[model samples]
Target: MTRSVYVTGIGRGDGRQVIELGVMELLTRHVDRVGVFRPLVHDDGPDRLFDLLRSRYRLTQPADSVYGMGYEAAGTLQAERGTDELVSHLVDRFHAVAREYDYVLVLGTDYADTNLPDELSLNARLANEFGASVLPVVAGRDQESESVRAEARNAYRAFDSMGCDVVAMVVNRVAPADREAVVERLAAHLPVPCYALPEDSSLSAPTVSQIVHTLGGEVLLGDDSGLARDARDFVFGGAMLPTFLKALTDGCLVVAPGDRADLIIGALAAHSAGAPPIAGVLLTLGERPGPDIMALAARLAPGTPVISVPGGSFPTAGELFAIEGKMSAASPRKAETALGLFERHVDTVELTKRISVLKSDRVTPMMFEHELIERSRSGRRRVVLPEGSEERVLRAADVLLRRDVCDLTLLGEEEAIRKRASDLSIDLGDAQIIDPQTAPVRERFAERYAELRAHKGVTQELAYDVVADVSYFGTLMVQEGLADGMVSGAVHSTAATIRPAFEVIKTKPDAQIVSSVFFMCLADRVLVYGDCAVNPDPNAEQLADIAIQSAATAAQFGVEPRIAMLSYSTGTSGSGADVDKVRKATELVRERRPDLLVEGPIQYDAAVDASVARTKLPESEVAGRATVLVFPDLNTGNNTYKAVQRSAGAVAVGPVLQGLRKPVNDLSRGALVQDIVNTVAITAIQAQGGTAQDAPSGR
Candidate 1:
């Protein structure tokens, strides 16, 4: 339940400040309480930045020193600062933080040498210590490594050997042309996500002065020195009013007048210093700070910026917010403005796309994409669906019918449709409801049922029985060429949905296999995980085939398929029949299809680790990373994908039928009405023929 990521680096540099900015921006769209931990901070008299964090955030435990940790073993020069010593110390710090927080972010000290072995050993130690996965980034405020590729690969190997699931490499300050080379280098060796960051000096330095100055505030303390300023996500805070609601926008915001709020927000935000970014927006008293007010700030900002507290007091009119933080009166304008700002940009649409991933029990529909709803002028794939069942199902059908995404044909009794709609309080005139109980389909179903069952399993009892289930009858409509695609998994199992398709529509030629892809989505990316729920345990050839089909499906979803044959071992690291299966499967893929970018015998991280690609098997096309992972077996594939789905708080979209001539989707047995509608949309889109879309920018 406590899923944490270890964000380690060196000193305060290693491009950490920039990396932290990216992490912080990423967190805003996803987590809530991201914590940071620096196990080793050199004891150089007073750390002004850390101290200011304490005062401004009002943290109970100053991040400076969580406990009475003395100055005895602080820097790398200390005898106990060796890798093992450092890892042990790091592990201990993680454990301590893990107890109180759901997830603890472990930051590495810049004091350690940026050597591959040491960095990996350090991560392995911490992963075991905190029971976490490693998302390693190559940190350093240095030029591109002309040849540090080998070292990066070495680090990945260590991380892989230690069983870290996912790994990432951030090539800091990389040139544009070098981007391809770097990507190829890493892709050859590792199987992971490798991002080559361009040199944007803009995000490197974050000065508190800039923040304060931007808001016309002042630097309260630590005015000079290595204080960071480039924030990925920003928050605006005010003690008086109109501030707390701004948090709804881009970053997390706090509404407090003074140090109390500052402390709570600061400590919580900075917990994942290297993992994700968090900040507080401070609103001072009465706008203009008198002498005393000015002095109070000199202690808070340090090198960070401080904004001037608001100055004017406007009149309150109506019911915007009847109360503030302490239940004070709020002006209608001020309160409404703040809330409006949040709603406009805080990403409700993206949230809608990944509802399953968030795993929250509550949700408000935030449909913002026109593409999901709009039909092409020429590509209207009209679908006929039944109407009148449950409130949720009816409402869902209406959404599609109204949106023109599908031409729903609702089948039911005429009076029953109206009565059911009245009971559910939904309008049904917009959708077509054919009364199968009294109309043509009822007669057609009886005729067809008798025609098919007449051969052997003949009986009037069987004919009536078969014609009764609406789903079965609906599939027959499609089989009889009455409809293009049928969506029938609202209150049924995968078998129920597929059996009809298999019996009626049947398989397409060249489509030798039948499997599925569950679209795994997070904030910034969408991954197509195949054969997860479908093929229980496929052979090597089947896996290779699955990889190929999944790749094609991913392309349809607008993903460039860099396929990785996912295995327990990366290359020849481990020996077993399972690993070889992946290896052979990967080979078969290359032999059969040479146009694609594919590789195998790779671990999860290697398929994703760009840095890992830079070294191990660096010349191989798919060692370090593969975005589309071809799992060696269902045991590892199903469980690993699901674990990532649940553990990382990701959404799993479907066991979308692949390698089939037609689009037939399976739904969760206990799916909601919206689930039924969405499944229909997915199937319709595939049938209608649109380019596969890129992952929705994860929320």
Candidate 2:
């Protein structure tokens, strides 16, 4: 049976969309196929929240299938055909979606401008009929802590009285200072878990695109990225150029008469100079700057949005002030902010238990990524990123911090990192920034490096120069226990990243050699491909060691260990040195760990395909169900993994180095922001002594 969660607001301005989006994220983290249904939507053109959810989560549900009816139609049906008929129609539509998905996120009726009577009772009735547990949202804006707590309790009781399963209550938009008090008070009185979300001005602030839509303005200039910026404050430019420039603030939208060319040029110039970066410029009174002035403005700030409105400054100001930001398909940064807020404030683990959705056995790429993040958060560890000044690294840092996954230390020049973050509009919240050349720890690191490399004819002076390199500095931090692990190579070479580790944090006592594996996240399940990164060629004994290490790494991250010794031949089909090496390695694995299921000299097709396995080597336990595939050589392994990654559209998450005393992973130089995030999370998990049995289960 499909499980469902109903997210409904008690009234308008509850900011329930955050909870809805958050719940959808939580659902997707555990299950593969999730459906979204909104019982009643405003008669407006399209539901912004639904569109946002579909785009953000990549929902495959058709557009017409997501909604039952608009508010007007719902109200008309309720009035003419009675409430029973209205609810029956909605329930039927919802069941159609529920049957097609593993789980459904049911958005209840929004009590905004609806003629329906007793919306709370209606929402409760629909939730009960849909068989979804109700998660009620209460607006705590402009309310005292006590009042907010009382309102939350009342909302819960109202649903419970109607026989609705009240899973949890969320009090959103509470004042930052009162958030703790509200949560504490509700926790003492309410039977269910309650979360209080402090008001984030950014969530409420309108973006430049929203302002353009509200004023029906024409966009004379700006890119989508610039338009997506939040207009935190409105700066009116009636004053002279110098005073108006002083009035500008970061993320403020400047409003001035289009004829005021001096103020316009001054504001754009100030923004270009980075005195205080404005969101965009808004022109009023149906006036526009001359072509030359606009060309100059474009040169000043290429992507900055310059909008023209037909109304005067006063009316435009009023309209702008009245406009509030909505989470939609266009505003992804806001969705990130929303997810960050929700993950931080809510105890998602407890909430997931309350929701009681059973974990799926099949792990998709999304599920694997989500599990990595959740596991990293369970036992937080510090990870160092040596490519801190790199754009991808800084962006990943922003995401990791926002999601509160783990503590991060970014290695680079502090000023340059900050400047780059500012230019990119990325907030690297509280991430430790260190410049290796000037950091006080550099001297200590140099001394430690000299001690570690003393046998290699390295003096302290030579070590000092070597420690200045970001990769070595990061690896040294991991070695010296200053950081739990390090992830680098977004810009540096893989050798530059792991060489310091070889010198300082060497292989474990039981390990023979260090090797790397790429977690090949296919459409249905995750498979481990070993020795694709570090080793070029290995003897039979070293190949067996890599197999054992790869199995341990696979089991550490929740992949089952059924070993497949991949070769060009299966069974006794062919004879060659490569085949002989694989055969010997397989024998070594079975002898060393008699409990492991091993298949030797097996072709890739026979190892992975059950039909082929039956034809080639029938009755072999590891032939057709292998999860850990050990390649014979790097030349073959690297090319095959890349081939599958590009052609099959798989998410290859690694080159994760194994068999180190402390974890130090390297990224591809072309790693994306998400790849960096995944690698960092993996590094943190490695630092936590990652074990599949002890880690949180996605299944």
Candidate 3:
């Protein structure tokens, strides 16, 4: 049976879309196939929430299959054909989606339309009819703490009285100071889990694009990323340039008469100077600046949105103030904000257990990424990023902090990191910043390094200078247990990132050599490719150790371990030194661990394709279903992983070093923000004991 979660709001202004999107994220983390169904929707062009989910979560369920009926139609049907008939039609449409997915996230009706007098009752009835456990959201936008608690209790009771399986209650849009009190009060009264999310001003602040849509304005400048900036405040221009400049604040939209080129130029110039980065400039009174002025404005603030509207300044101010920011496909940053807020406040593990979605048989790339984040959060550990000054690292740090995945210590000059983060408009909340040059801990780190390397070196002076380097500082931190792990190489070479680890952390007692694997996330599943970034060449014994470590690493993650030792030949079809090496490695693996599934001297096609396996090595269990592919050498492994990554569009998430004393990972120099985030999460998870679970059959 397909499990379903119905996210229903008690009334308007509840901001249930946050709850809905959060639930969708949690669902995708555990299951491969999750569906979204809106039982009732407004006739407003298109459903923004569903579009956001489809784009953000990469939903394959067609848009036509997601919605049952519009509000007007649903109301008409209920009035004419009775509630039972109306629900029956909706249930049929819902099951059509439910049957095709592992879990269905049913979006309950929005209370925007006033014609539906008993909207809560209708949502409850629909949830019951669809056999979904209810996750009700209550609005607390302007309510007192006691009032909000009362409403949450009443909402839960109302759903329970309706015979709906009320799984949790989410009190959203509450005042930030009142959030704790609201949750405490509700917890005492409610029978199920309760999550109270403090209202985020960003989620409510309008974007430049949203303001444009609201006023039917013309965009004279800006890119998509610029227009996505939140309009936190609206600053109307009427004074002199200097006087008006002082009124500017970060993310404020500058509003003025279109003829006021002085104000426009001043605002753009100030924005260019980064005194306070304004969202955009809004021109009103049915005018646009002259071409010369507009061209100068372009140079002053390139890619900053300069919008012109026909309405007068006063009316335009009203419309801009009324324009609320919405989470949609175009504004992904807001989705990240929503997910971050949701994850921080809610106990997702408990909620997911209550929702009771079955574990998926297939793990898609998105699922794997989601699981990495969730697992990191379960037992949070501190992972330091040595490349703290890098933009990608800062952005990834913002995401990690927002999602509350793991504690972070970024190594760099504190002032430089803060300035860079501010320039990027990234909020690095509570992330510890350490400057290796000025940090007081550097002295202690130097002493420790000298003690550890005294056998090779003679003086503490050399160790002091060496520990000043960011990579060495980070590695020493890990060795001394100041931090759990470290992720670097975003702006450095792979050797610069991992060499300090080999020197200080060293390999585990049972391991002979350290190796690495890339979690090759294909379209449908994840595969582990070993020694892609570490070893250049290996003898039979070292190759066998790599395969064994790779298999253990694969099983540590959710990927099942069926070891594939790659060579130029399959079975006895061809013979070479390379084939002989792989053949011997396979025998060594089998001799050491008979419990592990092992195959070698196998061609790539035979290791992956069932038909090729049947022809080449019939009745071999590990021939075609290999999840852990151990290449004969680094030359083959590196090129193969990169080739597949480019041509097949796979997400290669590692060079995760196994057999280390503590968890430390390396990133590619061209790593994106998400790649860094995943690597950091992998480091944190590895720090949390990296235990292997029972292997399930691979997809």
User: Candidate 3's residue-wise lDDT over 1-699, tens digit each?
Assistant: 988999998878898889999999989887888999998777767789989998888888999899888888888888898888888999999999988988999998878864775889988998998889999999999999999998889899899999999988999999999999888888889888899999999999988888888899999988776677789898999998889999999889999999999999998887777677788899998798999999999988877899989999888877777788899988777888899899989988789899997777777788888888888888989999998999899989988887889999999988778766654556676999999999988889888888888899636899889999999999998999899999999988988988899889999987789999999988777899998989899999999999999888887787889999999898888888889999999999999989999998888899998899999999899898888999999999999999999999998998899989998898988888899999999999899885645222245
Ranking by lDDT: 2, 3, 1
| TM-score of each candidate structure, all chains considered together | 0.45, 0.94, 0.89
For residues 244-301, write the lDDT of model 1, one tens digit per residue. 3334232222223444444333423332231122333344542333565445444433
lDDT of 2 at 439: 89
The clash count of every prediction, one per candidate, is 70, 0, 0
Q: Residue 495 error for model 3, in Å?
A: 2.7
**What do the candidate models score in CA lDDT, each in turn?**
0.52, 0.89, 0.88
Per-residue lDDT of candidate 2, residues 452-480 (tens digit): 89999999999999999999999988888
Task: Give the clashing residue pairs of candidate 3, or none.
Answer: none
User: Which should have the higher TM-score, number 1 or number 2?
Assistant: 2
Error of 1 at 614 (Å): 3.3
